[model samples]
Target: MGPTLDSSYEDWVRVAEGVVPPGRHRVGGREEDGAGAVFAVVSPRDGSTLASVADAGEKEVDLAVAAARWAFDSGPWPRLAPAERGRVLLRIADLVEEHRSEIAALISLENGKPIAESYGIELRAVAGTFRWYGQLADKVCDEAPHTDPGALALVTREPAGVVGAVVPWNFPLTLAAWKIAPALAAGCAVVLKPSELTPLSALLLGRLVDEAMEEAGVPGGVLNVVAGDGPTAGRALGLHPDVDVLAFTGSTAVGRHYLRYSADSNLKRVWLELGGKSPNIVLPDAPDLDAAAATAAWGIFFNQGEMCTAPSRLLVHSSVAERVTDAVIQRAEALRVGDPLDPATEMGALAGAARLDAVRGHIDAARAAGARLRTGGAPLDPAPVPGGTYLRPTVFDRVTPDMAVAREEIFGPVLSVLTFDTVEEAVALANDTEYGLAAGLWTGDLSTAHTVSRALRAGTVWVNCYEEGDLTVPFGGYKQSGNGRDKSAHALEKYTELKTTWIQL
Candidate 1:
């Protein structure tokens, strides 16, 4: 019998300590790799040693890549009809929903997210992504451009061969699905490298994909999950000439590295979904101050504020800054930070120990830089549940643009409040960041919303709301936030190439 999705905190704790074996490299049809050293995966919840996971080093990376290459060149996956490919993807979505609770528990165990969030956000998105792309598969039609009467011109989209996808630890399965679903739907093979900190869930996903493909009369090697860190497995995939396209979701620095790797290798098409320092501007005439204030608190504290699209900087109009700031402080202080396995928990641990320390450093630096710490600037006292890497929800008011806390992507439950005198300054401050990933605006006037949204540099602008969108609209960023888009039918463009055919009669 398979290990169940443990219900109680005690049952989950048992699984965390090893009721289920840790994930491994799922290469080709093989589930084990003996080529590289094993790394210990630690649970930030209670500081227990989760398990030792086998690494996917250079040789293992090569093996996975080779499998993907072979699958693309000669396997039945690429050769199948578009509708058939879509059926496989649909099957994957069904399989994901069937095992939702188990996967959610596994993710919370490794990623240190609350179980409710794990189930609601990551798992929910994962299944939806597959379903959306699967439905879009056959709907994508080739184009026949108008030309001279005697001649015809045709444009058709084709799979771009093998893809190398690397996802970060923040939202493991959701981000992985953002890259994986579209590629598979487009008939492209992928070698997915999930962050070492959160590889277990991805490995589990790979197993389900294999099972889905087999049931759909497709080959099993269409996708591979290699568990390794950035330097080895990621770099290998980036520099490999065999990969036709590389899609990554991580830091801007790593995004730059992939571009360099592309230049150094066969000039593979590289698409990145990088870092963000998104702003949430609450104007004096906000449609509802209480609602905006609540969203601000939720935006900065959800998932322990590990979201790439998180509203990290709260820019308030000077007139309402104090009231809004005070309201947010009260909400932040009220958030329950405790055991992730516990149902009452509203917040969870940082991804791991290193992240906890780095967040503390950022908070300390903000203190030295003269930003007023209105609430929480240190680790939770007496340790919530003992040894868990839990930081108190932090808020900094009177923050200037130059402050590191205001400019940097802290990737934690840290919020910086800056006051803006006019709409011009608010727009300027929102557009000031090098990242153009996402931003939030709250205003009562529709014209201001329209004009300011157009003026802001972010790819996604949430008016009167934050972190809200569906798969129908494309999700991506501008400037240093990386290239290409994820979600929607536009995502297929990254994995498929267009070919032009000219005919003369």
Candidate 2:
């Protein structure tokens, strides 16, 4: 079922409230909030209020976990045939696709991305994640290990019960699917804590799950969502002893805190996909300067660079540094910043005002630390829509490796360009940062491509393309970018635990 079209702001508001329904927390198959009072969900695009949800404290967390534990232990979900689960997942995917526009609109309003691109493209990706994992639910398996003749042994895979998924504001729906699809496919109940800045989509997802599960016969209490701040709802999920697994996608600093929090409990499995100061290297002999320049623009500017894989660090070989930087600046200038609902709008605002402040502070610091701002050094005026949190894409030239702009994850449409004389220097500079989420290399030389690809210590490397991959490839990071992989058949492993059984013959 696709999303029903809404004509006005009132209609959109109606859709928003209908998605989650004005409610407390859905605990133990009932509507109620635990401790904290009601809080509002605001739209970043225009500062319009979306929904007010119960803050949901520890009591609610306990109730949600207990319900999930009950569902996993006594409900049909865990015991149901794998094909049955697969069918339900397929149904969810269909419903998601049907409601794509409504879902995308809600996401754009709350998270502040262009509605057309986000809803049209990203939402489809969101739905497909479930469809992709649904087909693989039955394919997950474990093999018997070779053992001594005196012993008979077998290895089995089982779902880690009660997952605590903490998702960030950027790409809320898509990233939420990254955690939800795999865990559900593996037969685990989820208590998702979406970022406070963009909780509408998460709440809507709860409604979608309800509809999908009911149609597919998934029992109640299998999937729950609690909307609140990280310290309260997020901490409760990560630190909950009953939650068997904790999966998160956010910043490196927060990921570390979750790691420490989870360790205090049953040592529940922790899977994190964290930050990146990923490099997009332009080699001296890049095949197509024009194409590479355009891709480089998209790499850092797409979603207004509110992406973990945003290639914020542009390492250009001295030969093409001037040409590439000029082209990138030109493209950044032409981008239209306005209402996200417009199909022609290429760039959306930063996710929220707080994010805008953070980006502004980073740019100011870079300037104070002696970097040259080539263009777009500040936020744009409120567009015709008014109250929108927009920023002109900023670029800095002559950025040194030691500069904070070059080293840190700005998580904005701020590009820092640095120059290097040789291949060795380029590779060294590209790998200088603490992050290893993704890196892009543009080179006409086959040997250079192969060598640089291997040398860069990142999880995913794009040879000539940037951000081009389907759900099949594995994605994660190295060094401080955090551990565990997302997408492909490997993600299921994170949600499932391996058990070894032995019998004396």
Candidate 3:
């Protein structure tokens, strides 16, 4: 008999928790590895063990890389007609749509995000990314200069060979698709290493790709997945000479390590999307203090402030600082921090216990350095649920630009509010961080928006909102936030190489 589908999330949860087995990886047309003599996959929500996965050490990384390289060089995928590739990718996107509920549930379970939000937003965004890249597959154009009269020049774009995509934990499936779709669209094979905290969804994606490609006529070994610790599996992939490109999303310190590895091993293409300490500036001319406060609260606390481009620093004009701070505190305190599986839950746990500790340490340090706490100092007691990495939303007032809490990227639900007297001071404070991933400006004045948009060093600036993005726009960071762009047609450039051909007759 065929497997019966579970309609509701509650039924799915019961099945996923071992009444029915969560699926396994599809490596070369078979369900090869599930939980046989390997690493444990535990739930951050209740700390209960989920499944043990393959250890996937250097040996497995090598095998995955080999499979990817074979697919890139000798397999029919890279050599397939561009329209054919595009169509297959579109089929993959359709498969994503078909499995949307299952995929979203896996994401929420693995990443500790609210289920409704994951299903309602994140999954749709991921599908949009795949569809966008699928459309982009055949649209990439190469141009020739018309400088020489007697000489002919031709240009073409080709895949970057095997790509090592190392994605972070925060937005597991979305970020993975950010790297994978473009690379696949550009005809490059991928060996992806998802963060240990949230590998389940990525593994599920591997399964989906296998089924989709089989239906769409994509060759075997075109994509591979291996989940393990960053230092071991991730570093090895970066340092592997055969891997032509490494696209990483993580912390600054780790990015530097990958850069060193890439440089030392093969001088391979290394693209990183690193840390952020984005500023949300509220000018004195802002009309609605309530709207600004609410938006700013979402800016800092959304996804428990685990976003790479989250606006962690609130640079408020002196005139409205007190009002904004008070309003923001009210909103922060009102956030429903509880089980991510609960439909009423607005904010969920930190990625894990270690992250909860890190959030606490940063809060304690800020306190020791004399920053005033506005709300939420410690983890919620009696606990929101059973075993998730739970922490209440935290807000720190009187934060100076130089303070560690203000300057550093604390990937948590911590907001640092600082007052600025003048527009110039506000601009300075906003650009004070080494990260330039994103910034938000709230002002009634058009002049201020244009001025600050030009002046602020972030790659993405929101005039009245935060975390807003579409597939048509580009996303990347300036300074240490890392290089190269993601999303839009530009993202394909990272995965494909340009070649110039000269002919004279």
Q: Give the winner by lDDT.
A: 1
Q: Across residues 151-255, which tens digit of lDDT does each residue of candidate 1 receive? A: 999999999999999999999999999999999989999999999998889988999999997787666679998998998889999999899999999999999
Each prediction's TM-score versus the true structure:
0.97, 0.95, 0.95
The parts of candidate 3 lying over 4 Å away from their true place are 1-26, 29-37
Per-residue CA lDDT of model 3 for 1-505, tens digit only, reads 1112324546546534542223344455455553343677766777776666665677778888888888888888898877778887788788888877677666667777777677777888888888888887887777887857778888888888999999998898889999999999899999988888777788878877878778876667788888888888898898899999999999999999999998899999999999999999998788787999999897777888899888889889888899999999999999998877666678887877888898899999999988999999898896776777888888999887778999888999999999988999889888877889999998888888899899999889999777786888999999999999999888988998889999774
Q: What is the Å distance of residue 291 in model 2 from its true position?
A: 0.9
- lDDT for predicted candidate 3 compared with the true structure: 0.83
lDDT of 1 at 386: 86
lDDT of each: 0.90, 0.84, 0.83
Q: What is the C-alpha RMSD of each candidate to the true structure, in Å?
A: 1.9, 2.5, 2.7
Candidates sorted on lDDT, descending: 1, 2, 3
